[model samples]
Target: MPALRNIRMLTRYTAWANERLFSALGELPAGEPLAARATGSGNMVRTLNHAYVVDRIWQAHLQGQPHGFTSRNTEDTPTLDALRIDQARIDAWYIEYADALTAEGHDEVVVFQFVDGGAGAMTRGDMLLHVVNHKTFHRGYVADMIYQVPARPPSMDLPVFLRDTVPRLT
Candidate 1:
C-alpha cells in the first residue's frame, strides 16, 4: 500500500514537472544551441527527442497501439512545438491513468515486445514506474543540455515541482 502511495505521488510529481519543462521548452528560440556535446553524448534536442519517442512507445504499449520506435539509434525530432504538444498530451494521459488506477490494475501483468523485438511481460505497476523513472532520467539529461544553452533552464526537480506547484499538499 505504501508503495502504491509512493507511486501515486511520483506520478503526480512527474506530471507537474513535465508541464513545467514543456512550457520552458516552448520559450526557447529556434536554432538556439540545443545541447552541449562536450557535456553529454546527445544534444538537448536529441535527448528530448529520445524521451519523447520513448514516451510514445510506452504509451502505445499502454494503449495496446502499435509502437513507433524500433531502434535506440534512430533519429526522431519533430519540431519543438510539435514535441511540446505531444508531451502535454502524454503527460495528461499519465495523470489520468494514475488517478484511475486501482490496486488490482497495478497487479495485472501485460505482455509486449520490447523496442528491440524481445518479448517480455511486466506488471502494470512496474510499467508505470518504468515510465516515471525513464522520464526522470532523460529529463535530467535535458536539463543538463538546457544548462549549456544561453537561456536559463527551468527547475525540473521533484522537490521543486512540489514546492512550486503543489505547495498545499506539503
Candidate 2:
C-alpha cells in the first residue's frame, strides 16, 4: 500500500502546484494571458487549456468513457477564472480517485487510444502518474509564458508543495 500512499501524495501535489500557478495567473493584466507569445501553445491561456484538455482526456480514460477531445487543446481558451474553476474541479476528482484506489486497483490495466489515434495501454497507477507528470511539464511552459509578461510565476516546486501543503509520504 506504500505505492498507493505515494500516488495519493503525488495527486495532492499536482493539485497544490496547479493552485499556485492559477494564483499567479490571477495577477496578470487583463488580456495578458491571451496575448501572443512565442512558445508552446502560443499563449498562456492556450497552454493552460492544453493541460486542462489532456487532464479531461485521461479522466475519461480512467472512467472508461470517451473524452470527446480531438486535440490537445480547445479551439477557444477559457478566461483565467473559468479555467481555474474547471482545473480545481478536475484536480479534486483526481485526488479523490487516487485516495480510493487500492493496491490492486492501482495496478489494473487501462486500455486507451491516444489523441493521435494510436493504441495505448498503461496501468492505472501509471496513467495517474502520467497525469501529474504531464501537467507539471506543461506548467513549465506556462511558467515560461509568465516570464514573457515580465512577471514572476509562483513557486510550485514539489518540495514547496510538500512543506507548505502536504507532508512527505513516509
Candidate 3:
C-alpha cells in the first residue's frame, strides 16, 4: 500500500529526527534544557515532553483505547536521559505500527476525544501524519531555545533525514 509506505517513511523520519534532536540536546550545557524561557511551556524539556504526551495520546487513539491524559502536558519535566528512553520506546512503537498496518487500515477513521474533551476524528494515515507534524512543530520550538543558548541545533529538515538516514531511497 502506497499510503502505508508513506506513513512508515514519515514515522521513520520522525524517529531519526528525534534521535538527532536528543543527541544535540545531550550536548547542551548543563541545565540549558531546564532553564526558564519566555515560551509557553517555560523550557525546552517541557516542550519536548508535550510532544511525547501527544504522541502517546495518538498512539492510544490508534489502538482504540483511552489515553488517560487530562491535559496536553504533564506536571513534571522529565530529565533528558529519561525522556530520551521514553521517546525512543514510543518512536519504535510508531514505526512498528506503520510497518504492520494494512492497505485499508490507513483510511479507517478513528474517533477520539481530545485532551480538551472535544470530540475528534481522523483517518489512521492522517493521524500518523499529524503525529509526525506535531513533533516537527515542537522540535522547532526546542531548536529556537537551543539557539537562544547561543548554540546550534541539529538540522532536522526532511531532506536532511533523507540524505542521512535513508540514502538508499530512489
Candidate 4:
C-alpha cells in the first residue's frame, strides 16, 4: 500500500511537472524548439515528442492493447500546442491508472514485445516507474535545449513537486 502511494505520488508529480514544462515552452518564440539542436532528438520539440510517444506506447502496454507505434517517435511532429494537449491527456491517464491500482495489481507482470521485436516483461509498478523516469530523462534534454535559448527551464525536481504540489492533492 505504501508502495502504491509512492507510485501514485510519482504519477501525480509527472503530470504536474509536464504542465510546468509545457508552460515554459510556451514562452519561447515560435520555431525555437523546432530549430535543430546538438543533443538528443535533434530539436526541443522532437525531444518532448519522443517522450510523448513513449508515454503512449507504455500506456497501451499498460492497457494490454496495440500501441501502433513502430518507432520511438513519429516521422512528423505535432505543434507544441497539440503535443501539450496530448501529453496532458496521457499524463492524467497515468495518474488515474496509478490511483486505480491495488498492491496486487502493481505486482502483476506484463509480458509485451519491445518495439525492436524482443521479448520483455515488467511488473505494473516498475513499468509505471519507467514511464516517469523516461519522461524525466527527456525533460533533462529539453532543459539543456532551453539553456541554448538563454531561457530558464522550469524545475520539475521531485522534491520541489512534493513540497509545492503534492500536498494540494486529495
Candidate 5:
C-alpha cells in the first residue's frame, strides 16, 4: 500500500518534468523540433511522439480498452504546440489514474496486446512505473537532440523536479 504513495508521486513528477521539457522545446528556434536528427525516430518531435503513443497504449491497457495504435508513433509529426497539448492531457490522465488507484487495484494485473500484436501482461503499478520510466528515457533522447540543436535543454533531472516541483525527493 505504501507503494501507492510512491506511484502517485512518480506520476505527478512525470507530468511536471514533461511540462518543463515541453516549455524548453517550445522556446527553441523556429523549426528546431522538426529538424532532422540521426536518431531512429528522425527528429525530436517524433521521439517525443513515440513516448506519447506508448503512454496512450498503457492507458488503454489499464482501462481494459482498445488503444487502436497500429504503430509506436504516427507517420507524421505533430507541431510542438499540438504535441504539448496532447502530452499535457495524457499526463493529467496519468495523475488522475494514480490518484484513483487502490493498493489492490494497483497490484492488479492487466493483460493487453502490444502495438506489435504481442500479448503482454503487467500489474497496474508496474505499468505506471514503466510509463514513467519510458517517458524519462525518451526525454533523455530529446534532451540529447536539444543539445544537438546547440541549445540548452531544461534541467529535467529528478532532483530538479523534487526540489523545484512537488513531493520532495523523499
Candidate 6:
C-alpha cells in the first residue's frame, strides 16, 4: 500500500513538474535567440516534444490503440502554443490514468511490441515507472539546454518540486 501511494505521489510530481516547465516554455518569446534551439539536439523544445511523443505512444499502448512512433528518429515539432496545449491534455490523461490504477492493475502484465519491432512484456507498474523515469531523464537534458541560454533556467529538479510544491511531505 505504501508503495502504491509512493507511485501515486511520483505520478503527481511528474504531472506538476511537466505543467510548470511547459508553462514557462510557452511564455518564452518565440523567434528569440533563446528559442532558436527549439528543434536542435538536446534542446528544451525537442526534449519536450520527445517526451510528448513517448507519452502518446504509451497512452496508446495502455488504451489498446494503434501505437505511433514507429521509429525513434521521427521528428515532429509544433508551435510553442500548440505543444503546450497538447502537453496539458496528455498530462491530464496521465494523471487520470494514474489515479484510477489499482494494485491489481499494476500487476497486470502487458505484452506489446517495441517501436523497433521487438516484442516484450512488462508489468503495468514497471512500464509506468519507466514512463516517469524517462521523462525525468529528458527533463534534465532540457534543463541543460536551458542553461545554454542567456536567461536563467527554471529550477526543475525533483527536490525543488518537493520542497517548494509539496513542502509538507517532510
User: Which candidate number maximizes lDDT?
Assistant: 3
Give the alpha carbon lDDT tens digit for every residue of 73-170 in model 4: 99998999999999999998999999999999999999998888898999999999999999999998999899999899998899998888655656
lDDT of 4 at 11: 93
Higher-ranked by lDDT: 2 or 6? 2
Quote each prediction's TM-score: 0.83, 0.95, 0.96, 0.96, 0.96, 0.85
Candidate 5 residue pairs in clash (backbone atoms < 3 Å): none
| TM-score result, candidate 3 | 0.96
Instruction: Give the per-residue Cα lDDT of candidate 1 at 99.
Output: 74
Relative to the true structure, candidate 1 reaches a TM of 0.83
Model 5: CA > 4 A from native: 167-170
The C-alpha stretches of model 1 lying farther than 4 A from their native spots are 33-41, 72-76, 167-170
Tens digits of per-residue lDDT for model 5 on 21-105? 9999889999999999999899999999999999998999999999999999998888889999999999999999999999999
What are the runs in model 2 whose C-alpha is more than 4 Å off?
Answer: 167-170
lDDT of 4: 0.92
lDDT of 5 at 112: 91
Compared with the true structure, model 2 gives a TM-score of 0.95
Q: State which candidate, 5 or 6, has the greater TM-score.
A: 5
Residue 21, candidate 5: C-alpha displacement in angstroms: 0.7
In model 6, how large is the Cα lDDT of residue 117? 85
Q: Where does candidate 3 clash, by residue pair?
A: none
Separate clash counts for every candidate: 1, 0, 0, 0, 0, 0
Residues forming the 10-long window of minimal summed lDDT in candidate 3: 161-170
Worst ten in a row by lDDT for model 4: 161-170
Better of 3 and 6 by TM-score: 3
158, model 6: CA deviation in Å? 2.5
Clashing pairs in 4: none
- Write down the lDDT that model 5 would get: 0.92
